[model samples]
Target: MWNRPRFDLKVRLTLRVAAISAACFAAISAYFLVTADRAAHARSDSIAAIVAKSLELQQGKVQWVANPRSDFPNLDPVAAYVMTPGLCLAFRGPGGDMLQRFCSGAPAPANPPPQAFAAFYRSLFDPGREAARPVVVRGTKLGETVVSVDPAVQTAEAWHEAGRLMLALAIALPLLCVLVYAALARALRPTRMIRTGLERIAANDLTTRLPPFDLAELSAIRDVFNHLAQSLDTALAERSELTRKLIALQDEERRHLARELHDEFGQSLAAIRALASSARQTAAQECPSLLSECDGISRTATGMMETLRGALFRLRPPDVEELGLVASLEGLVAGWNGRSRGETRFSIRFDGAFETLPAAVSANLYRIVQEALTNAAKHAGATKVSLELTMRPDEIALAIDDDGRSNEPAAKSGMGLLGMRERVAALRGRLSFEAGPNGGSALRVVIPLEASDRQLLDHAA
Candidate 1:
C-alpha cells in the first residue's frame, strides 16, 4: 500500500537512451577520425613515393647529386601532379636537407621542421613518409633523389575537424534529447492521465473514469483502470455496508445482553440480599451463629452484584445512549481520573453543539474514547493526562495526550490500539498517534460530519 516516488517515465527513458547513444556515437566518432587520419597519411606517403620515383628515373639520382639546385627542377611536372592542400613535396640533397628551390606546388618552409614537432606528428599519422632512392639511368650512377612530405598540417587539420565534429555533437545531443523526451512524453501521455486517475482512486474516488485514448494500448489500459476502479468501488461499498450492519447487530446484541444480566442476575442477587437480611433478623433473636451465617451470605450476594454491575458497564455504558456522546465521554474520563487517584491529572473539554449526533457516531465515539482512556490509565505512566472533544462545523476532533514518554509512543504490541483503529475507521474517521509536546503520546481522531441523506447515499453506493 506504500508507494515510493520514482522519476517520470519520459525523463528516465530519455536519459537512458541518450546515454547509450552518446556512448555509441563516441566510439564511432573515434573510429572514423582514426580511419580518416590513417587514410590521409597513407595517401600523402604514396604521393611522396611517386614523386621520388619520377624524379629518380629522370635525374638518375643516387647517393649524391652535385649542385642540386640547378639540376632537380625536372620535378615540376611530378610536383604539379602530386601536390594537394597540406601536402608538400621536397627534394633533399645527399646531406639530407630540404632543397627549397626544387620544391613546387607548395610554399617551402624557412627551415627544416623541428625534430620534436615531426616526432609528435609522426606518432599520430605515419612516421615513414620520407622516400629516397638511388637513380641508375642506363646502369649509370647519379646523386640520390629524396621525396618527402610532413603530415603535421594534416594532423592539425584532423584535430580541427575533430573539434568541429565534437562541437556539433555537443549542440545536437541536447536538441535530440529534447525531441526524444517530447516524443516519449507524448507516447506515454496516457500514463500521466492514468496516474492522475490512480491518484483520484487513492483518495477514495471510485467514480473516477479515465478518458478515451487514441492509442489501442492506452485505450486498453484505460479500460482496465476503469474496470479496476469500479470493482474496488463495488467491493468497498459492499464491505462498508456489511460492516455497518454488523456494528448495528453488535450494538443490539450488547444491549440485549446488558438487559438480560440486569433483569435476571440483578433481581436474583437483590432478592437473595433481602431474604438474607430478613433471615438474619429472625435468627439473631434465637441463634447468634445463624445470624452470622446469614450476614456472610448477604455480603457474598452484594459482592456478586457489584461484579455484575462492572460487567454490564463494560458491555454497554449505561449513560452513552441516554445522555449522549459528550456526557458519556466526560463520565468515562471522570472514572479514569478517579481510578488514577491523583497519580495522573485529567482534564475534559467540549465545544460546539455536542448533541443531535447520529446514534452510530455517538456509539463509536464513546467506545473509542473509552478505549483511549483505558489505554492512558493502564499503559501511559504520565502524571498529567488531557482529553478534549471538539465539535467543528464539518467534523469532530478528539485529542488525548499524556506527559509520560517523550518524542515517541510505546510499541503497539497488543490488540487495544488495533481495535481502536478499527472502531475509528468503521465510522469513516481518521486516527493518528504522535509525540505529545510534553514527551508523552497524543492520540487524535477526526470524524467528518455529513448530512444524513448524503451519508445514506454514500452507504448505498
Candidate 2:
C-alpha cells in the first residue's frame, strides 16, 4: 500500500509561517490600496474646486458661439490658468446643457461612468478623484464643474505599493524561514542525538549515550537519557552474565550426562551382552527353545545401546567445528531425508565463502536449520523442502522453504522457531517465517556483517 507524504517539523513550520505572512500582507495591501485611491481622488477634487472657483465670473459670461470654429478653443486666460492634465472647465446653461468647454491639457469627461461614482461612495472615507461643484455667479447657477480621478494614475500608484510589498515579502520570507528552521533544528538537535543513542542501545550497544546539550531543558533531557542508557547497559550486562552462566552450566551437564551414559551404561550393556551369550550357549544344550529367548535378549540389548548412542549424538552433534557449517548441514539434511516418511524430500544449496564466520554464528545457524527441518517433518507435513545459503557483500542469508501447509498458530509459539529467533536476535540479525512459495512454510534469516541500519533498535532502550 502507498502512504501519503508526511511533512517534518521544519517543513510544516515553514509553510505555516509563510501562510500567516501572506495573509497579513494581503490585508495590509488591501488597506493601502483603498486608502491610496481615496487620497488621490480627494487631492484632485480639492485642486479642481480651487481652479474652477477662480474663473467664476468668466464662466458666467460665456455665450454660445454664432458659428462653430474648426475645433473647440480655450480663451487665453482659461488656457493659462485652468489648463491641466485630467482637468477641464465646462460652461452649462440653467437646464444643465453644455455651452462651451475649456481644456488645460487633456479634456475631462462630461460625465464619467456610474461604476466610478459607485466606487467613490464605497470608498467614502477615501474616494478617488470624483468631485463636482456648481459654478455660481450672483446667485445664479451658470454650470456644473466635475473632476474625475484618472483611473490609470490610481492603478499605477496601487501597483507600485503592491510591488514593493511583494518584493519585501519575497526577500524576507525565505530569510525568515531559514532563520527559523536553523534555530529550531539546532534547538532540537538534542532530540535527534538522543534518538540515535536509543537505537544503538536497542541494537545491544549498551554504551550508547546522548551528547551534552546547551539549553537547560534539553540538557536535562540529555542527562535523563544518558542515565537511562546507563541503567539499561547495567541491566543488560547482568542479564548477559546470568545467561552465560546458565548456558555454560547446561552444556557442562549435557557433556557429563553423555560421558556417564557412555561409561556406566556402556559397561552395563556389555556385561548384559556377555551374560546373554553365556546363557544362549547353556540354553542351546539344556533347552533348545530357551536359546531363542536368549538370542532375542542379546539383540534387544544391542538395539538399546545403538539408540542410546544416537540420542547422545543428537543432544550434541559432533564434527560441527571440525566439519564446518556446510558439511554439518549436509549431514543434517541427509539424516532427515533418511528418517522422513510419506515421500518427503529435503535438499540444501550452499554458496559463497563461510571461512570467515565466527564459530558461534556457524553453530547457531546449524541449530536453526536443524530446528526448521524438524518442524517441516513434524508440523509442516511437507513433501519437499529446499534450503538456500547465500553470502552478499554486507550480509549472510539462509532460506528454507517447504511444500507443506503451514500451521500458523502453532508456528508462532513453536520452540523450534523461537530458538531460531533467539539465535538470530543474539546475532543482531533478522529472522522471519511466512507462507512459502510452494504453499508451505518458509524460514528466512539475514545477518548483517555490521549492525543493521534500522530505527527499530531504539526499542532496546
Top candidate, metric lDDT: 1
Instruction: Give lDDT per model, in order.
Output: 0.72, 0.71
Cα lDDT tens digits for candidate 2, 146-212: 5554453344455667677878888988888888888878877777877788788776667777777
TM-score of each: 0.73, 0.63
Provide the RMSD of all predictions against the true structure, rounded to 1 decimal: 6.4, 8.6
Worst 10-residue lDDT window, candidate 1? 405-414
Question: Where's the lowest-lDDT run of ten residues in candidate 2?
Answer: 452-461
Model 1 over residues 1-461: C-alpha lDDT tens digits? 99989988788889998898788778876787678767765675566567656866556543356655545536677766766644555565655565542433444444445566456656866743655555445665443555444465555555556666777789888998999998987888778788899898876668899999999999999899989999988887777677777767877898899999999999999999999999999898888889778999999999999889878887778666689777787777787677677887788888766567777788888887777766666666677878888877668899988776543243243456776777776766778887776577888999877777345534544
| Residue-level lDDT for 210 in candidate 2 | 75
For candidate 1, the C-alpha RMSD (Å) to the true structure equals: 6.4
